[model samples]
Target: MKTKIIYLLMACIFLVSCQNLNRPSGQMTRVERVVSGQTIEIADRSVAVPLLEPIRLIGIQAPDIRQNPWGQEARIQLEKLTLGQEVLLEFDTQEKDGFDRLLAYVWLGGKLINEYMVKEGLALAKPDFPNTKYMERLTNAQEKARLMGLGIWNPNQPMRQTPGEFRSQNLKQ
Candidate 1:
């Protein structure tokens, strides 16, 4: 009887652990739109993708509303890049951030959106979480942009505090 109970307990633990790992894997989906700078829609047959649940372009950091300069332009460019395009999403360890969005690599045609933004000097390479495939590219892009003083790199650019910094400030409270 004790052996049976132990087995049952083990089974229960296994089932619970499996549940968290059951989120969606890498799935190719056409991007319906760029909801915001860090969010996107991956159309699925089960249902239309939720706007609130966005797939972040992992391993890259775009300006958030509270982040560095040119956030508006970053969002605008994201909108332009992803609207009505068929995008491929690659998922890593995190399914999403705290907002329940899907953390994913958004690829349009053959270009990796995360790397492109940084290379254009429109964003910075941030090692946000699990996805780091394009780290080198993102770094190089930011360096080139900074050297050129293009886009947000310009002296007059309005820079916003990063999410990390914001979180840290709040944490001290």
Candidate 2:
């Protein structure tokens, strides 16, 4: 009887522990930390939760600090919009990246921060990711920014390189 009781208790604990591991598809959560323009730490609000992984916004690629002024601008903009604020996280078909960061669409009030980044030209639309939930919207925003010469899109400015290119060149050196 004791053995059976122990098994039941273990099962109960396992089930409860799994509850907040993956939030319901469209659940909104508060931001505990903003790691970068593409990532943030979430406040899971459950004691059963493990170490909180920072979430990577699914379809936007922002400049890196190594990109100099542009990278700093993107990070600053993201910080201004998201730090200490509540956001809605929408998970994609793929939950976690190889780095274990949650892949999500971050919504701030009525705006999608991913799209906002592109709209402001602080980031570029990354269509390579499978979850294309807001791809069209993001691409459109990028075009507008390019047309209006916002952020990294100024015609007089040097061509803005994607974050991937920046990293690849760094690796070559």
Candidate 3:
């Protein structure tokens, strides 16, 4: 009887651990501020340090702040959508970038913020490997935005270069 009980307990523990492994590693947090079109500062009390954590929205890249109208427009759009809002942060395979910013998919009011930005043409789909969980969704949104000639995709005043390209060029100067 003792051996049977021990085996049963072990089985229960194993099952619980397996379930945890399959669960989505996401957290609920409130947005402290919109850092930019593709980044936001969130309040995460769960962490020991950095009460305000900066999170980079995965699957999209917004124009740099110095990229002129498009950049400012992107930031404004993001602020309107997420400022002071409660968001759910979902992780991909890669959690942090070289800059130590948390990489995540921000979901607010049942909408995926990362995809929304791309769809609105305020940002471009940037598929970084190991974090391509939403690549197809983002790409489709980008295509639709491009077709509609919205925001950065506007033919009359289209963005001259991608944010990455702009940054690289600036670095050379």
For all the candidates, what are their Cα RMSDs to the real structure?
12.2, 13.0, 7.9
Q: Candidate 3: minimum summed lDDT over ten consecutive residues — where?
A: 20-29
Model 2: lDDT of residue 56: 88
Q: Give lDDT tens digits, candidate 1, residues 19-134.
A: 97743335777777676566676654675754334677777666665454466678778889988777777776667687777778777776778877777656677886465666
Highest-lDDT candidate: 3
- Of the candidates numbered 2 and 3, which has the greater TM-score value? 3
| Model 3, global lDDT | 0.91
lDDT of each: 0.70, 0.82, 0.91
Model 3 Cα lDDT, one tens digit per residue, 28-75: 888888878888998777777758889999989999988989888899
lDDT minimum window of 10 residues, candidate 2? 20-29
Error (Å) of candidate 3 at residue 108 is 0.5
Q: Rank the candidates by TM-score, best first.
A: 3, 2, 1
What candidate 1 gets wrong by more than 4 Å, as runs, is: 1-25, 48-52, 66-69, 158-160, 166-173
